[model samples]
Target: MAGILVYAEVRNGAVRKASLEAVSEAARLTKELGGSVSAVLVGAAPANAGEVLGKAGASEVIALAGPKFTQYSGDGYAAAIHKVAAQMQPTAIFVASTPQGKDLAPQVAVLTHAGVASDCVGFTVAGGKLLAKRPVYAGKATLTVKAAESLLVATLRPNVFAQTDAGAPVAVTTREAGEVSLRAVVKEVLAAVANKLDVTEAPVVVSGGRGMKGPEHWGLLEALATAFGNAAVGASRAVVDAGWRPHDEQVGQTGKTVSPTLYIACGISGAIQHLAGMSSSRVIVAINKDPEAPIFKVADYGIVGDVFEVLPVLTEEVRRLRAAS
Candidate 1:
């Protein structure tokens, strides 16, 4: 039986950062439990992706190859993963809680009759059973759950776990994707891979709130994000609700909950609804003029000044810092 199976997420012919974190997180748990970490890559693992997974701590990478499985099909992915799970009979299975990962994990869980946990923030082993820790009630509470199945399945929250690369060597094995067939097929798969930083993978994020005024002023936010080099741009629920940004960029209870190392909230008031999303960030910097703003309560650092004025200065400072480095 395999020890732990991590679903390696690939996007647009490359390895997704969430998949790297998933394997790294799994490796930690597996080490704690005296087990192994095995990764599964569907839809023809891209070149070097298997190696990347290994570096993230996969003891073995099963790379499923073929064009038929190129696009993410729920049924096809479930069948493919089911095939591996049956053979591996792992103690735990980890999948990223992405749009695609969410769809596939549940289907595989049903097929394997494995208990499933979604958006687990933490995990551990006790009495040979896996325990998952997750937030609930819009991050108002935390819950610990134990799956009854021998093969435990969970969807890992992206960016929730800090990635620690152990540098495991690559060991890639291939399986034909044709072995798994879907009842439905996606006719086209297209992506715009340029000019966007994936927030789930970013170590630092600069998010804007209603203080930005309008979408036209979004250029300031973009410049700030660019100043940080790898930082992603996020939006408050108010901004999203106002159609100032896409739902995917929303960071709140009703949106994407992020746990980056650094979270910069510009013009955000830190409402409970919004705090539900980013309160877990390691270091929060609030750039709001209001000293009484609730966000300052949770912020590790606060700049009591107008964001409109502060942001431009901050952007220049970050630019200078990066240039210096």
Candidate 2:
């Protein structure tokens, strides 16, 4: 049986949670295929990073390291991955559906002439072929795609699959990222102001909309997020378009798609476009004064009150609960 290869995305010398999810999924799939699971770590990685992947279920961890990989270069990284894939010739290659993964997956597919399924929520193998289930039509419909090539390449959406440990150590190997001709190089990376939590990776999200009135009123949402501790702040498309929040904070079909454990929609009248982004959330709580708001339709819990009047009370209650605990 051919092996499975997972691209373990690392940043700041640690593997990202999304890549760990991919690794876990790859391990599960490899068991079904009766093959071993291997992972490729690109760019600068910390020592013992392979052991981390081992615990996450990779039987073999390949570290591709060099000064050229210190920072991300799309062309260079894609070439390195292609070289590794050529060497391994695995049955399937899995990548996380992150900004970097989005850029890298297609390039590797194109280089290898392989069929690719992007933003896959789930997949299954049958008759020696891989089938992937993905969201389409603003996530209102599911599209199942089958890979025709010998190798299947796919990008798994973040937070969709749970990560698990394999309870054993694996072999680690290092390789030099040989020379590659690059078209563009990332000289500098400017990061946004760090938040307590990243919206995409957070388990809980507290979002506000135009009903918050103005940008000055965002403190209410922040206070609520603070009460949650692990929560991130999000914004509706209307507010984002109005320049009240950054594009990264926007949650909608036109912006970022999120699937958090709990989603709190404050003062948002859910539009189809907005719902398309967050409908996958496990639990939804909608707070809006209008009982007729569309958000109530999808909300597991609903609150009918003005956000200004409701938020402070909710924040205080949460703080009180935390204090008591």
What's the TM-score of each model vs. the native?
A: 0.92, 0.95
What do the candidate models score in CA lDDT, each in turn? Answer: 0.85, 0.87
Model 1: pairs clashing at backbone N, Cα or C within 3 Å: none
Tens digits of per-residue lDDT for model 2, 186-268: 78866677534767889999999999999999999999999988899999999998999998899988888888999999989
The TM-score obtained by model 1 is: 0.92
Output the worst ten-in-a-row residue range by lDDT, candidate 2: 189-198
CA-only RMSD, every prediction:
2.0, 1.6
Identify the candidate with maximal lDDT: 2
Model 1, 43-100: lDDT tens digits are 6778887678888988888987766775778888888888888888888889998878
CA displacement after TM-score superposition, residue 184 of candidate 1 (Å):
2.9
